[model samples]
Target chain A: MNRTQLFEQIKKKSSYLCVGLDTDVDKIPTHLRSAADPVFEFNKQIIDATIDLCVAYKPNIAFYEALGPKGWESLQKTLEYIPKDVFTIADAKRGDIGNTSALYAKAFFEHMSFDSITVAPYMGEDSVKPFLKFKNKWVILLAHTSNPGADDFQLLQSTGSGKKLYEEVILKSQQWATPDKLMYVVGATQAEKIGGIRVLAPDHFFLVPGIGAQGGDLAQVSKFGMNKQCGLLVNSARNIIYASSDKDFATAAKSEATKVRNEMENLLNSLL
Target chain B: MNRTQLFEQIKKKSSYLCVGLDTDVDKIPTHLRSAADPVFEFNKQIIDATIDLCVAYKPNIAFYEALGPKGWESLQKTLEYIPKDVFTIADAKRGDIGNTSALYAKAFFEHMSFDSITVAPYMGEDSVKPFLKFKNKWVILLAHTSNPGADDFQLLQSTGSGKKLYEEVILKSQQWATPDKLMYVVGATQAEKIGGIRVLAPDHFFLVPGIGAQGGDLAQVSKFGMNKQCGLLVNSARNIIYASSDKDFATAAKSEATKVRNEMENLLNSLL
Candidate 1:
């Protein structure tokens, strides 16, 4: 919920890996199809198999949303399945008008019980601030993303700082909330720049996606990105979710998740 | 769900209003609380009552997501309740890794059947291009937001053209998708600047929020932003939803919606 609590969980679990529940219906094991809600069934299994090994479960909302009502039902159930000690992220990338964002904060935090939700900061403070109003919830603002088009706007220089637009977003947004509640979304693909990001907001967490399927080196990410509390949630979605796709799909997912968690454990151990 | 079909619905309804379903749990009618899922119940009622009055229903995903599993359920039901002829917008504002975005596209278009979804373009083309790949669906990119902090990044001038960051985004993103499938969110509060926006994106539909509660002037927005097919969806969310707190909330909402529709009709007439 808060930074220290999140840090303690990472230490307790001996891992900083956040299993991304980016569950695609077609991608789920065929065995799950007969379950009441296949997506949730799959997620429940994954959480059941891997909860002790990881400190977080980041469910990318799109996967569940794609199934229509059933998909949403699955998403809700999956959120419920995740343990309270593990940080949960909607990974919704939501930000909007102030009042609307306030409602969104309530949706993810109050309703779903996610400890955090990823936010797009393009709309500025008003769009992001409403989410921060929730006690202990984190707002992971988009800083330097890993995508190719990240060059288009985020890398552009701003008036206040010769630094890129994302840098400006990071520096400027810090005024709105404290590091304990405010985090940054630094693409794991941009692993080389994690040090620069840490310099910007030294205390906040970074929801680093683009790790496995997206080709982000975990070594570099952990090396340059981790803070004193191992402040990086390295999310691996596809590589783990589709690790086997056989009868042992959930077991295979656990193995894949374990591999990442093991590497993260190594990194955390090295940090001391 | 394509541009022509969307345009036809606008003409048939004689209104360019897109009622925003930024429904908050605390804001919902007490009667709906008795239902199994109050948010969905509220959305079902709103859709049933306002079906013919507006051409589109933009459910701000945050509100539904805030309720967690139920919030997503409400979003699904709201999408289902909307008439097929009326455009449905998943105002989720999602943008992320290409693989993740592909899933988001599937969730909104293939699963939920939304005609369009809002996205944040700060991550650049790769983050946005995946959404554009869906046929007949639109990506309503955030260009100039209405919030006060919008000045922080969107209004900043890029180096070469002296164009504002949003202006540069408008010009460059136009190359990714045709105006038919791409729309920019130009805030109604920036009505005076719409003329400038038109210079870059003359024909793309503008999902204009902030008209009612955000103090965006409709007249100025239409005068500067309108294109031949009345290429503007003026959203009025809170001013309509919370129009009345009493038992007559639906009736009151209809009256408020009707007033905006009448004004939109007048705007259309003037444009024609």
Candidate 2:
């Protein structure tokens, strides 16, 4: 999906929610275990429940990867099941050298047909540039992550640039891609810093994780992070998906997603 | 495999050579295309021919992932085909949040049964710590990479510690894992810097790539990077694997591996 189409989906839904499919086999409802492929079955119902409530689906690749070959089959099925209009983000934090990164681009973009894939910026511009070559695809580069370990290297100040490492990443990466092709993963936990990052890359969308399960405030994220285009796809996974492990799991997931979407709707109204 | 087991393999084989199984379907011999699983067939032959010449096999994950589920099956088969005593390195530069990283560790260590997996250290301590939890599995962290893009962030001086970002990675990561469990990727192209890195972590092995295809010098890597335990696994992929795309491909691969192993043998002798 292009930036304009993604914005259109957001406006149509009245929510910029990106439901994260971090579906673990052990965490799913036990009743589904008898099914041939429980992981895909669980994801299918979750998508059915929440499809209209969100504009994007971010499937954390690690969950599928841990399951091995069968897991990848589940992933392929899940990706094909998601409506083409809704943006699909392969939350695979993949980055490597130029040639290898090209293969990764082929894996997610060409082969699997995800609209975007999250990339780690540690390998720098050449690693990121490969993904940009594909038209209408997005590269959501990691900036200030939500994890406690984000403080490790991301926050360090670079002597040459005088900006913090992530700030430098944002600044340097702008030279490689425009807002239409590039986005940043600014954790909702770092809500205050979003305003500053907005100033740095004012037009680029921010894929905001850490909203619900990670203790990030949705109101703060909307207040500080939103651009005119509704440039925030606030993600909530466990709080919504695992809301109920009973037979009513899908219905419970819908209720949770509705609650969050309603809050997002109110936030959008307040903006006007 | 543990450190002692790995060193024993190096001594027993008289080489610290690591053959990179970066198997691309397009690059394999055309005759093999008729096989049901050409990539696996090519890899099996490569393993059969050169298993004794090298101590480690580093399979770059992106290549297989590009082919989807069947590719993963090939990877699994190739992993199972390798001799248990030889070390297996999943050159999958994967790292994420604590919970997610744990799943990655499980994917490579538990599901795939790799001895060690390469991890990008941009996410910090918590991201890396999960991979260390497995009993004898290893985390080979990226230090100074061989790519031209490595110059971007890794070489920059950090204002906080007055050290290069890669240097800080080396120092901080030491607190996470001992030499027994941790290794660093010090590219053979950065041969001059390997001496300094060796001083930083004298006992930890260095998985050095960029020997043949990338123009890294073998003599320099052996002289500066090798410790008393021959703590270096020099990797050469394209130069060895694609030595000939003909009927003699496997034999040609074996010959290239032999030539490199002979050079490594001479280096090992000089060290004694």
Candidate 3:
């Protein structure tokens, strides 16, 4: 989906929330274990419970991949189950050489039909450019991640540019793709930095994780990260999906999602 | 495989050759498309032909992932088919937040049983540390890549330490894992730089790709990059695997692998 279409979805739903499907099989409800594809079954219910309350669904690809080829099948099924109007993200942080990256773009964008795939920027331009080649697809490059290790190299000062490595990434990547096709994964845990990051790429969308289970303050992220088009996809995974480990897990998820959405609606109505 | 076992295999094979199974289904011989699992069939023949000549088999994950669930099956079958003596590399180049990285490590190391998996160091210590938790597994972090875009961020000088970005990666990563568990992906294309990178992590093995088809110099790499234990796995993918497009593809692949192995053996004999 293009930036306008995504923003439209957000406005229509009165939310910019992106529910993450970090669905680990071992953590799923015990009753669903007997299902043919428990992961997909779990995701189906989560999507059903929360689809009206969110604009996108981001599936952490690692959870599915850990199950082996069967995991990939579950992921494919989950992708097919999500409705077309809501955006889908293959939260597979993939990047490689140009040719190899092209095949990845083909896998996520063409074959499985995800609207976007999170890419690692360490391999630099050619590694990321292939994903930008697909029309209407987005490339959410990692910048200022919420993980503790984000400080390791991302915040290092570049002698040449005098910018932090993540800052350099944000500035340099603008030459590759515009806001229409490119976005940044600015972790919501770094709530204060979101404003600074916003100033760097004023028009670009930001796929913000680290809010729910990571204990990031949503108000801070919403205040600093939102833009004219509601340029934020604040993702909440564990706190919603695993709200309950019983038969009422989906209902619990919906309640948690509804609470987050109600607050997001107030913010969108007032802020955007 | 442990470091000693890997070196033993290198000594036994008299070559540090890593056959890259960057197997594009479209490029495989047309006759094999008729097989029940054509990609797996193609890989089986290639593995049968080159297993003796090469010490490690690095299957580029994108090739399999692009084909969807079936592609994953092909990869699993290929992994099971490779003998225990040969070191297997996922070449997935995956890294994420701590928990996520753990899942990826579980996927590749536990489920797939690869000896090593290439990881992107963009996220720093925690992102990579989880992979090190696995026994006898390796994390071959990207230090300097072969693609043209490698110049974009890797070579940038960091002001704080006065080291290039990749240099800092090599230096700082040592604090997280011993050389036995950690390796670097120092592209053979930049043969001269390999010497400098090797100095930073003297004991760590380097998985060198970009030879053959990518025009990396084998002689320069072997001369500058080799350690006492022949600490380099020089990969050649398209140059060897797609050597022939006819029914004699396996024979052609064997011939090419034999030529590269011969070169590597000479390097080991004279240099070591």
Candidate 4:
């Protein structure tokens, strides 16, 4: 969906919660393993249970890819299953050179039909621009990631610009595309920095992925991160999907998602 | 293969050349497009032709991934077809959180049985170390890439160390893994920087791309980048694989491989 449509979805749902599908087969309940495609089955149930509570679904590509060929099939099936109204982010942090990046764009954008795919900006402008070419597709650039590893390189100061590498990324990348076609993956763990990063890209959406399971508070994220457009996609995967391990897993997922969505609704009410 | 074994393969073949299997479906021979699996068929022929000449085969994952499940099947078949002695680099360029990174590591090293997988170092130490946990499998970290975008963040100076971001990456990443399992993706396009980068990590192998197709010179790279063990696997993808788009594509690929290998033999002779 385009930026306007995405914002509309946020307004309609009163929740910008993005349910992450980082579905690990081993982590799922033992009962589901008997299914033909355990991963897909788990994803299908999660989608069915939580669709109303979230506006986006991010399938962490590593989990699917680890399963080999069957994994790709499952992933394809999962993407097909996800309703088009909700935004889909292929949390496939893929980036390469010019020609190769185009191929990656084709993989996620054309073949799989994801609305956006997260891309690592360490490779620079040319690596990012190819994905931006698709009319409605979004390029969610890694800015300040939530992972402990974010401290490793994201904070380096550019020799010329004197901005932190990610700040440089945020500023430099804006020249490539407008806020409509681009977003930043700002980790929810670093809520203090969210205000600063939001100021840098005031209008662009931030796909925040650290609220649950990663110890990030939604209130702080909402307070600092909400734009006039309510531009924040707070993602929680394991916390909701694995809320229960048995046959009640999907129902439990709904309960957890409802709680989060209710919280999101109150936050949105304050902002609107 | 281990570093010593990889070096031995270089000695045995008299070549440190790495043939990149970036087999695009549209770019393959017309006759092969009619086959059961065109990409695998094309890769099979190319592998058969160039197997003896190159010491390593780096399959650029974007090409296969773009084709979806079928492409992955082709990659698996091609991986199975390649002889074990030659080092296999899954040019997947993947990196994420600790658990997620492990899955990607399993995807390539365990599922596909690749000797090494290239990873983007943007997310920091935790994102990269999981891939290092695999025994005898290498993590070819992206240090200096060949694309025009390498100038983006790679050249930025770190706040504390005053090292360029890529230099900081090369130096800081050393703490996570030893030279035994860690290598750098130092692009051959940056020949002038190779000597200085060589000074930082003298023992670690540098998987150099951008040689033939991207205007990188082998001799210049050899003059600056080579170590006592011939620690460089220069990659050539489109130039070798798409030498001819006809049924003679394999023959032309072999001819191109022969030419590159001959040059590499002379370079290795001087180094040894």
Candidate 5:
């Protein structure tokens, strides 16, 4: 579950895609609703069908959280089903005071058996450091988000230093943890600037979401963002998970995953 | 509840207090452990005992998320148990892509009835605007945090702007939502600089969370951070909820809440 193991898996699979499990109940095909736990069943199929084509599985916490208790049960079962060789991320953007954060780290890393959890950097170092205390776990900090309103503050020139707030976060957070346990979320839609970001934190992995449905170019991201280790975890959620709404939804998901993985294979090959 | 309604309750109670329901299962009283759902039972008692003394109840999402399915059930029950007159906040620091954020807004405001939610401003406008779309809801943005390592980025001056990152977040987030639908998380521990922050965000309410265990001076925060409308919701989580673990835990919680409210009343009186 450590960074080295994660990187080795990425190489062995010839893929860096992290399938995002942002499953919404109403959005899933109607046929699966009758299952004991529809969400878990959906995730289980996706994992079984495409585990070899991905290096990571990211389950956004909000989706499970929305369903309340049943959703949580699905999340726990889904986590248990994911192969240990593949990295698991509880895409829960949690950040709080130190003590509270320590408990959060324990929840995802120990209690739930996740390899990592997404953390919001807005709360500062103490909030993030608690998660960093766990060995072999990664803390994915939000950088330039893909949303249209990302310009409101993240891109605003800091009144004192004149750098964008995200750039400031990238520079400062480097002191809290190394590339091994720290990663940055550089939205794939922000591909143009990935070159600049790589310059700042050249060795760290970047959890690049926003590909597929978000309109981010895969080749562009690979060209500008890739490091010696192919430091990019390109995530595709809607395009893969909901590729087909029929009873063959799992099979459809695997095909979509393979397509993306094939494209990534080409990108990784070019890297060498 | 709208901002005006929250203000009225604050004045009526003579308390600008927002007790935090960071209900950690590990820390719940041993007696409650035998209950079917100890976390919910513990939260229900806390809400019943302190509902009259405080204007709002803010629940940190991590504690609920830690317990998985059962924990989420406790959170839902606790949210429903809170009185209609009091404001409810899902203290989830959520900010994501615009589409994903819109779903989060629906989950918290429409699906569930939380009146407000804390948000990380790192993603800028689109990530925050989704939360503001609902009527009579508030998006409390993270500004200068109460954590020790906030200096990592929030305190750093922009490369040329001469303004700190937190100051920029306060100023720019104004464009995304009006003060009526938005608030800022200005840490109480940053009392010395509250005067400066008040100047930048004079109209927006601030959810200050470092008063008790963090050693922030309530008086200093009131003097420097308060506005004409008494726009400060000072929060004390651990110091109040875990005030005493004895059988009189609820009574001890009420006493601690009363002490903060009394101090706040004095501050309000002086401000007027």
Candidate 6:
């Protein structure tokens, strides 16, 4: 989806929420195991329950990949099942050299038809530029990740630019892509830094993870991270999807999503 | 395979050559397209031809992932077909948060059973630590890549440590893994910088890509990068695998691999 289309969805939904489909087979309701494809069945219900409440659905590729070929099938089904108006993200942290990265872009953007795929910026420009070649497809590069390991190399100060590695990633990447095709994955755990990041790329969107179960405060992220366009897709996975283990799991998930959406509604109203 | 086993294999073969099975369906000989599971058939022939000449096989995951579920099936079959003595590498540059990374490790290490998997170090310690938890498996981190874009963030000098961004990746990553389990990708194109990288990571093995097709000089990489253990696996992909487009494609691939192996043999003898 293009920036305008995504912004339209957010405005219509009143929530820039992206429900992460990090669906683990072991964690799904026990009764679904008998189904031919439990993972897809679980995701179908989740999408049905929460599609109206959120503007995007992010299926973390690792969760599906762990299950092997069948997992990929589940992921494809989930992608096909989601409403076209809502955006889809292949939360696969993929990046390589130019030619190899082109195949990845083809894999996620062409074959699977995800509107965006999260890419690791470690390999630098050529690794990321392939994804930007596709119109309306987004490249959400990893910035200050929420994980404990974000401190490893991303926070280091570059002597040449005198900018933190993540800052440099944002700054340098702008040369390759505009706000229309690029976004940053800024962890909600680093909410305080969101204001600073906003100053760096004020127009670009941020795919904010680490909320809910990861303990990131939504209010803080919404306040500091949102731009004039409400440039944030706050992802909440486990807390919303696995809210109940009973037959009413989908309903329970909808209730959790509704609560989050209600809060996002208030936040959007405050912006207006 | 463990470090000792890998070194022993290098000693036995008298070569540190890694055949990258970047088997693209479109690139394979026209005759094979008629066969069922053509990508696997192409890889099987390539592996069968080069198995004696090379000690390792590195399958760039993008080639397989691009074909969807069938591509993954081909990868699994190819992994199963490789000799147990030969080290297998999933050239899947994947990394995420702690819990998510564990799943990727499980997908490649447990389900696919590769000897090693290349990981991107942008997220830091926790993103890489899960792969280390698996016994006898290796984590080859991207240091200085071969692509032109490597100059973007990797070569930038870090103010805090007075090290280049790639150097800081090597230095900081040492705290999370030992030389026995951790290796770094020092591209053959960066042969001039190999000496300084060897000083920082003297014992860790280097998975060197960018040979013939990418204009990386094998002799330069060998002279500057080799250590006491002959710690390098120089990879040659397109130049070797797509050496010919006829029915003699397998033989052509074998001939190309043999030439690279012969050069490596001389280099190893010189070191001894």
TM per candidate comes to 0.90, 0.99, 0.99, 0.99, 0.94, 0.99
- Considering the true interface contacts (CA pairs under 8 Å between chains A and B), give the fraction that model 2 also has: 0.75
User: Which docking category, incorrect, acceptable, medium or high, applies to candidate 5?
Assistant: medium
lDDT (0 to 1) per candidate: 0.83, 0.93, 0.93, 0.92, 0.86, 0.93
**What TM-score would candidate 4 get against the native?**
0.99
Say which docking band candidate 1 falls in: medium
- Span of ten consecutive residues with least summed lDDT in model 4 chain B: B153-162
Q: What does the i-RMS of model 2 come to?
A: 0.8
Candidate 4 lDDT by residue in tens digits, B1-272: 78899999899999999999988888988888889998888888999999999998989999999989988999999999999998999998898988899999999989999999999999999999989888899999999998999998888877678788889999999999999999999998869899999999999999999998799999999999999999899999899999999989999999999999999889888777
**Per-residue lDDT of candidate 2, residues A29-77 (tens digit):** 9999999999999999999999999999999999999999999999999
Error of 4 at B122 (Å): 0.5
lDDT string for model 3 (A148-226, tens) is 8999999889988799999999999999999999999999887999999999999999999989888798899989998
Interface RMSD per candidate: 1.9, 0.8, 0.6, 1.1, 2.3, 0.7
TM-score of chain A of 5: 0.97
Mark the regions of model 3 whose C-alpha exceeds 4 Å error after superposition: none
Between candidates 3 and 5, the one scoring higher on lDDT is 3
- Model 6 chain A worst lDDT window (10 residues): A152-161
lDDT of 6 by residue, A1-272 (tens): 78989989999989989999999998889999999999999999999999899999999999999988999999999999988899999999998999999999999999999999999998889999999999789999998899988987888998877899999999999999999999999999968899999999999999999999989999999999988899999999999999998899999999999999999999999765
In model 4, which runs have C-alpha deviations exceeding 4 angstroms? none
1 against 4, candidate with superior DockQ = 4
Q: How many backbone clashes does candidate 3 have?
A: 0
Q: Is candidate 5 or candidate 6 better by TM-score?
A: 6
Q: What is the lDDT of residue B137 in candidate 1?
A: 88
